[model samples]
Target: MSVEVVIPNATPGTGEGPHWDDSTRSLVFVDITQKNVFRWDSVTGSLQKVHLEDEVGCVVPCKKGGFLVAVGRTIFHLEWSSQKLTKLHEIPLKGVGNRFNDGKCDPAGRFWIGTMGKVLSFEPLTFDMEKGELYCLDVDGSFHKRLDKMTICNGLAWSSDHKTMYFIESIPGQIMAFDYDVTSGNICNRRTVVNFGEFDPTDPENLGIPDGMTIDTNDNIWVAFYGTGQVICFNPQTGKMLRKIEIPCKRTTSCCFGGENLDELYVTTAQAGSTEEEREAFPASGSVFRVTGLGVKGHPANVFNGNF
Candidate 1:
């Protein structure tokens, strides 16, 4: 597959959470460490960025206009034109050293987001054992907890029928499936759907760290694996990997479907945590990439309901 660089330097650190805003016909994403939220127009080839004070985890477009931004435990309402930010709701973690990570809007218009622990130790190689929690911001502006005890909550997707929800926790090395209720936006009957246990464990480069994912019309989950340098397509129902598209960068962060027909897959990558040699080997480490000719389209991103 021929990969094209959409943004030469998307971010300095942690380029993640790409969301396609159908309203504005632009692709929006964030650079966590840089505290930058970016928007791009593929047709016009224009790029715009908004700088926030804290680490920006993700940005999703709201139906009522503007955007819902998850940054440092607080989700804010952002007006890209005026560069104004208003506090929407905060994800509570108490004394735990955790912050929000990857998230998206459910089909019912509720904003579903999750968090990760901040503290990490290399002596014995440990991250915050505080656990990851998934939270949903309801249409009436109330926040509720949905899932718990995950590490580095990452990608999210729902089936075309809206009866299934696919989620990932970076450390678990798998994509989990849950019975989803579209009306109430609830999930239950959790089970492993696409565990990467089959991947070669001896290779450090292929550690199956599932990061971000999107679903196709045929119910195929295309997931980006961090440290693996590839995005893979898996059939959750069949428990099999259908295909893998290799990437140039080592840290493949997240991906979303967009473009005119929604067939173009936009992928984000990071260079922040890579070794010097790895960064040197892949010069376009932090760039945004685009892949086409997959012959499958993804669902339109759900718009956030900011009515509350």
Candidate 2:
């Protein structure tokens, strides 16, 4: 019943992927458009941003120190101290106008990532339902393309038991579930888990867009609705929405649980849809936020250490 938006004022245009760092008890996220990575400590209310020359789409802490960054069309291992970027792999399809989008590490320590067609140009949407493949880079340095033909591969989460996987495709607004085999880190039996209704172009509130998501300790799924200004919670098994957290910003991009005890929910918002006047009115449009409640703590993702 009680909700408050922390960090309501922050820099705008932040398309971020959040990572929970247990070592420092801080929540890390990036402003992809701004080319900056931030570490927020809930205990001291400290926020630190590291400037980078290139756009860093996602950041996952590396087990050996530094971070594995998913930049525009390639994945790299970054050494934060020296500002060095080492290219790891180039996603296979460059001609299709598809580029890496959302990514996360599976429980098996393999990184799962998806690509989307560039929306700026007239190029047909690169989603090949057969080509928009999900990929995994094992600790052994071998790469595997898991699934494909996905348009804007977004939300990715694994159940606590590591037997189920949840994924989302942004355009059509569908959340899918897969039966995951832990032994081989393979997924199958893909099925629709949830679907949002269409929005009336005349009414703003009814439009629900799919974005990033995080799973709670109790298996509840919290998804950020890109254009809806809200985060909806759902029971994964029943596909029922249990609650919604209202956000003031129109483009709520992503969320994750991070804190000393992992009880606080940190959210990232964007100024992607702001008009010139609206942009000036809300300068910190692309800032991070925090909220409490929902009784959930996220499982920190494991970084690849080059060991199979």
- Candidate 2, residue 172: the lDDT equals 68
Residue 82: error of model 2 in Å? 1.4
Candidate 2 stretches with Cα past 4 Å from truth are 1-11, 93-96, 121-132, 197-201, 204-207, 280-284, 305-308
- Local distance difference test scores for all models: 0.85, 0.74
What tens-digit string does per-residue lDDT give for candidate 2 at 1-308?
Answer: 34455554554555578878888887778776677777777668788777776566677877777877777778888787687888888876554466666778777667777776655521222233333557777777777887766667887898999899999887667899999986677889999989774434357656467788889889888898876568888998998889888876767788877777777777788875466775575455676767776566767655665632
- Across residues 162-270, which tens digit of lDDT does each residue of candidate 1 receive? 8999998777577889999989888899998867643453576565578899998899999998777889998999878898988899788899999878998999998
By TM-score, the best candidate is: 1
> How many clashes does the backbone of model 2 have?
11
TM-score per candidate, chains pooled: 0.94, 0.88
